[model samples]
Target: MRVIIVGAGEVGRSIASNLEQSHDVVVIDRNPDVVEGLTYSLDVLALQGDGTELGTLRAADVAEASLVIACTDSDESNVVVCGAVKTVSDAFTIARVRRRTLLETWEGSQGAFGVDFMVCMDLLTAQAIFRISGLPATQDVDTFVGGLVRMAEFEIGPDSPVVDTTVQEADRYDSLTFAGVFRGEEMIVATGDTLLKAGDRVVVIGSPGSVTDFADDIVTPSAEETDEIVIVGASEIGFQAAREFEEHGYRPRLIEQDHDRAREVAEALPNTLVMESDATDTEFLAREHVDEADVVIAALDGDEKNLLVSLLAHRLGVDRTIAVIENLEYTELFETVGVDVAINPREETAEEIVRFTRAEQTEKVAMLEHDRAEVIEFEVGPDSVLAGEPIAAAATDLPDDVVIGAISRSGDLMTPRGETVIEPGDHVVVFVDAAVLEDVLEAI
Candidate 1:
């Protein structure tokens, strides 16, 4: 399928790279330099043009495109790009937005901006923070099948007891399936013989309870319990995060430096205690007893500021520190210095938009370890190679590393085994190496 992507920035480049391996990808940017850089860096065709204009869209061959993604920095620009695309072609359009209100508006009226789907970056970051906070020692977390199934990635720490244990030996949960293991640059599909390494990030999928049970067992028994959540800054992501916690029965504390913003958030979030003060004020943090908080999230306006806040909270004795880092390059630096987790909005936006570009049967997708592998949910069609065949018999036709994580059929969950027969219309969640994603998707 021919795919056209607007905005050749980090997020746009990420989407282009993901789709380039399996589909026809074209990237557009107004900056001639950026377009030229992409021309050399990625295999996609790079065009120098404004995405909001019809002439530019036509030059990119929009008529023959199957998907168009509007990911310019400006939300208004992205919506307008999608709107402009609709005037010319019937390609599926997706827009990446930063504001919650815009997302809510589009959600209230599906396809409001000629966009078939919308990915809200800040909102996705907030949701990711909440999910990672709920799980213990998780590197990543995502849900599928209307929340009935959960996929989690946990790094096997050097101190973990299961570091050297094989997948089947450590996986004793009845409903949990070891999906895949990421060891540096290699992705190993989970199997009875696959051994868990200390630095490996292991992916698992199953019932939420079973996944949580597995998480609890792999982490240190003395891991701090998340009883208190402190959010620094009143940025949109921070506000949404506090709201998310409140909706889940958590009365979290929010600290905002701006008086007006703090007051507004306080009014909107009655359950959250909004404190108007500089988050970097060490004296204020001490006075508020921030040292006793279990989890501290830094969502300040600047990446460096968030890093400072996260480091400060870590020094204040917070058990965990999560920071929103805008620049992708700083994610590793922040984590290495002291922050427990670093959330990148661009990466999250790319993950959300790439799912729609997959095969027609793909229902949902969750990228793990920065897209080195993916856990994808897809419906089995009658024409599928796996349909009406035992999983063991069909296994020979699929990529050797593909792991069927979970299956849902007729409102019931099934733990797939060698003898399990895959029928039509069944929603199967599979963990596959990104190298063979197209191969697996085509076979299924």
Candidate 2:
């Protein structure tokens, strides 16, 4: 597909970097420096101009392009760019709007205006942070189609109401379903009679309202408060992650290999402890109490180095170890090697870009795993034929490789079994083990 991207920040560059591999990508930026940086690393065409200018859109040949993505830092600029693109192109258009107010309503004939979708970067970042922190015992929440349906993760607190409950009993909740359990670091596919245990992270699926109710049942804060999280890199993205974590009350200790870079990061983060040291050194890690840290975040610039540090930290018994991997291709291997969570900023950015460029019908995939076969969550419409059918019955119609792992209905969640019925208002969480996602959706 021919795609045009506006802006050249992390997100815009990311979109270009990702799509350039499989489709034709052209990036436009006002800043010469940003354009230079993109040109150096990517095979994308770089156009220097104000993204909001109609002339720029015409110059990029938007009329013949498959998609146009406005990803400038200013939401208003993106909106303006989209408006301009609409005047010349019938291509799908996505605008990156930062404010929640802009997304409150989908106005102005998006199809007619050449704006088929909008992305809120801050909201996406906040959502990711909240999931990592496990707010109110909610470990994670993956949604499909702007909350039409969602998969929520609930940590079984020591005092959880469902402590002694069986999965079957939990499934009996009117509007909720239990999908899976994260025992230690493993994700267990839930069964009707599976028993809840303290410290287990349970995944539930339902509508927003139903998911909240289910969370209230089992969400509980951890027994131990995390006082410090050791960050093993001080790159721009690493610093951003550290800042986000700090905002949520986690104490950050940033380590950098370069002395000058360490000093720079130290000055920028007034609250964080900056250490000038090589994270790959076990002795250095030991001196910093890396093993005793509540969490270890390896945001190293090198994927191999990050993987090594994370594996070492995990072996030393750190409660949780996260790694920011540069290579999206190595994510599964990293996960299998004991990295609790592998984050790729480029991948995240690309997913958002794809969602916007493809129109709202494309699932906004934040993370991919199991060779892109098993996605986190997917959204379907209420009018979907999958609605109002029992899960077991729905299973046969879906591709054999796909499974309805969970469902969200009226703000409640269900770890659905074949006997469980899907309703029109329900959002089904499917786990597909193949790339036949479109086939699965069609079957539904």
Candidate 3:
């Protein structure tokens, strides 16, 4: 497939890198330096030009492209680029946006910008942060099949009950599967004899109930009632997180260094307590009793500032620290430095755009172990190989690294057993090692 990606920034470069191996990818940017860097770093074709210009799109052969993605930092530019592509090509278009207001406006009026899909980074990041808060121990959490299936990554704490136990012994949940374990930098395909150790990040897949139960067993659960929440920035990400917390019946205190922006956000959020104060000020945070807060979100615009605030909150005894990191390189650094969770909007946007480019049969895809494995959800079509067949029969032919985690049928979710029969229209969730993704996709 021929794909054209607008913007040579982090999100655009990420999408280009992911698709260049399997498809023809062309990237456009106005900066010659960025295009040159992309050309040297990636196998994709890099063109220097304004993405919103007709001549540039024509030169990129947009008309013959299978997909066109607009991921420029500016929302208006992304929308205009998608609109321009629609005028010249019938290719599917996706626009990366950051504002919920623009997304809502475009969504209310179907296809307002000629965009077939919109990836809202702020909303996606907010949702991810919210999920991490719900499961305080997980490094990441994603749901599929209408929330019936959940995929979570958790680090085995030294005090965890499952630590030092073999995979077979820890397999107590009827619906849960220990997909894989990341021991340091290496990913180990989990087997019956595989031993789970402290500090190993384990990826688990199954129904939401089973995953939660397993999490409780492996990690200390947070308090039952979370009455206090603290937000260290009044930026868009911070505002969105606070808004989501409010929907869950928690009032959050938002602290901003800029008085004008704080006042603006205060007026915008009626249920939140907005304060004009620098969050890095230890005296101010201590006076506000931020250390006792249930959760502290560091969502300042600057990644450095977010890291600093998160570290400060952690020192002050905040229960959980979630930092908004724009640079993907800083994610592991944040986690290593004690940040409970780090949300990267650019990575999230790239993942969403890549999902659209996957095989048409794939309904959802979640990258795991830094893209070394994927948990994919798709409906079993009438012609699918597994349709109307018992899972045990199908398991015999599947790669040992691949596991059928769960299935949702007629709005009911169940952990798949050997006797479980797959039927047409059933949503099947499978965990496939990245090396076997193509083979699994072929079989399905």
- Backbone clashes, each candidate: 0, 17, 0
Candidate closer to the true structure by lDDT (higher is better), 2 or 3: 3
Compared with the true structure, what per-residue lDDT tens digits does model 3 show for residues 271-363?
Answer: 999988989889998998999987888989999999999989989988778899988898889889888788898888888888888858599
TM-scores of the candidates in the order shown: 0.94, 0.58, 0.92
State candidate 3's TM-score: 0.92
Question: Which residue runs of candidate 1 sit more than 4 Å off their true CA positions?
Answer: 108-111
**lDDT ranking of the models:** 1, 3, 2
Which digits, one per residue and each the tens of the lDDT, describe model 2 over residues 1-444?
A: 889999887678766755676678899999988888888889998889987888887888888897888887787888888888877788777887656557655464445335687775545543464356443444445666456666666657677778978898876555455656667646566677889898786766656677766665554444344566787888765676677777777667888989889888788788889899878788888877888887777877688888998888888878677777656678768866767676665455556666444344434443333224334444556766676777667666766655465665665556566687777656556655434655664555
| lDDT winner between candidates 1 and 3 | 1
Return whichever of 1 and 2 wins on TM-score. Answer: 1
Highest TM-score: which candidate?
Answer: 1
lDDT of 1 by residue, 300-366 (tens): 8999999999888888788788899999999878877878789999999898888767646598999
**What is the full ranking by TM-score, best candidate first?**
1, 3, 2
Best by lDDT: 1
lDDT against the true structure, each candidate:
0.90, 0.68, 0.87
